[model samples]
Target: MGRMGLFRDAPQGVAAVASSILACIVLGTLLERFGPGNVHSGLPTFGAIWVVTAAASCAPWNYALTRFFICRTGATFVTLDANQFTCSLMVVLNVIGTATAEATEWGNLGHGVTQILSILVLSEITIHSGMAADTAWRVSLIVPAVFCLVTATGLKLLRRNTSTAARLDVSVTGKITKSLLWDSFEVLKDFRVVVRIMLYSTSIRTELAMNNQLTTRFRTYFLMDAADVSVLAGSFGLLNLVPYLCVHYVDVLCPGHLG
Candidate 1:
């Protein structure tokens, strides 16, 4: 946030992060205290807490990254196009790998293939190269951490040569102010933004709900095993590529027609 000028007042960003961490710590402590026995027993129990805490820790930096990119692009569509293209491409590749795994009955091998495609992590290759699972997992995280460090360094270098105004800085309190809240409600008074938000929210929520229910539905209705369910899941991702591609090309061909 300091780097990207996300906050007009830099201390506001620092305070926001501090507050988030305090909240997460409170929540995690409660969970740890009164949660179920099984929750207290596993890697995931602590891992889940760590993930939330980590996100809180990284919030400012991630916001800085997003703000930097948005500024760099100058137009929202360029960022959207790039993000959607990358997301779609990863989904398509992962789905392809999953399909191949199903066809070949490679079990966990298939899963690792799709994981690599989705995350661009070479942990699978490391595992195959005789690295232990725990070691491979640790090493896999290091790759992204290193990449982020490099990317941030590059951005800092580039930013040194560019002159741009810092955008409107909204603090946590300012964003939640009574007047701002009312303003948000007023803004939603615009039918176009409301309609888009509603439609997108509805579709995304429905798809996510269906995705969550799918494995059970496949097991009950089709008697498919976990592996088969994975293959079926991948098919939806594969199908999404068509519409994603269409959206990309439409934006390219039509320019600001839709906008």
Candidate 2:
């Protein structure tokens, strides 16, 4: 990112990342609770199939999908660039929620196993035409969750790989703060790095926020019943796997790209 102004000291950059991650976590949790929508939509449903599928989506998004989205959206933030890396914290927090969906539902012990693809969403779609009300709500909750998780993860990996290729002009040669200071701070001395970093950061937050809410709001507020939500969610989870297949071979063309 041009923010480093020659990669200034990594101190500022790291601090920025730590701060952003913490903010995203706190905000995401609050947003998850009081933001709006049904209880499951706003909160993690440990027993909810929708939540589990969404959780799986986290692996891709948290790992590589970030790069694909950034470039596709013209955020083209460079991989490993200190300034923009902070923003990745947003992706991570999202993943954290998705990953924890199973835990949220475990019934009693606070732990549960998530399925590979959700069964709930498909059931909702099946019932969409016949069973209304409760079934519909179910679908709305689960299906959209599936879609959200899949979309987020897919986008993260896509953007990360693309940015790694675009590599910014600055080098990450600065030392990370070692002793006290705090874990979150990193420095960016470069001007160009600062500008470019800001350029990318400017677009991502809103983009993520909107998409995160759309599936749930659109459903709970508008479309089908809860059952319908679940079915829709499972469908997304089922389809999300198709992208991972691409990942297996992605490196064939671009060695180390998946890494």
C-alpha TM-score for every candidate: 0.35, 0.27
- Please report how far candidate 2 places residue 150 from its true position, in Å: 16
> Which lDDT tens digits does candidate 2 get at residues 98-208?
323222222111100112123344444555667553344334455544554554454344433223332211223243423223322332466775675575366334333
Candidate 2's TM-score:
0.27
- Each candidate: RMSD: 17.8, 18.4
Give the per-residue lDDT digits (tens) of candidate 1, residues 1-259: 1233432334433433344333322332332233211212222222333323332333456544332322221121111122312122223442433333332232223223443342334435454778764344345554444443454444334322111222212232144432222343566678996786687457533443344345446755788654566567655545544454455455455644765
lDDT of each: 0.37, 0.33
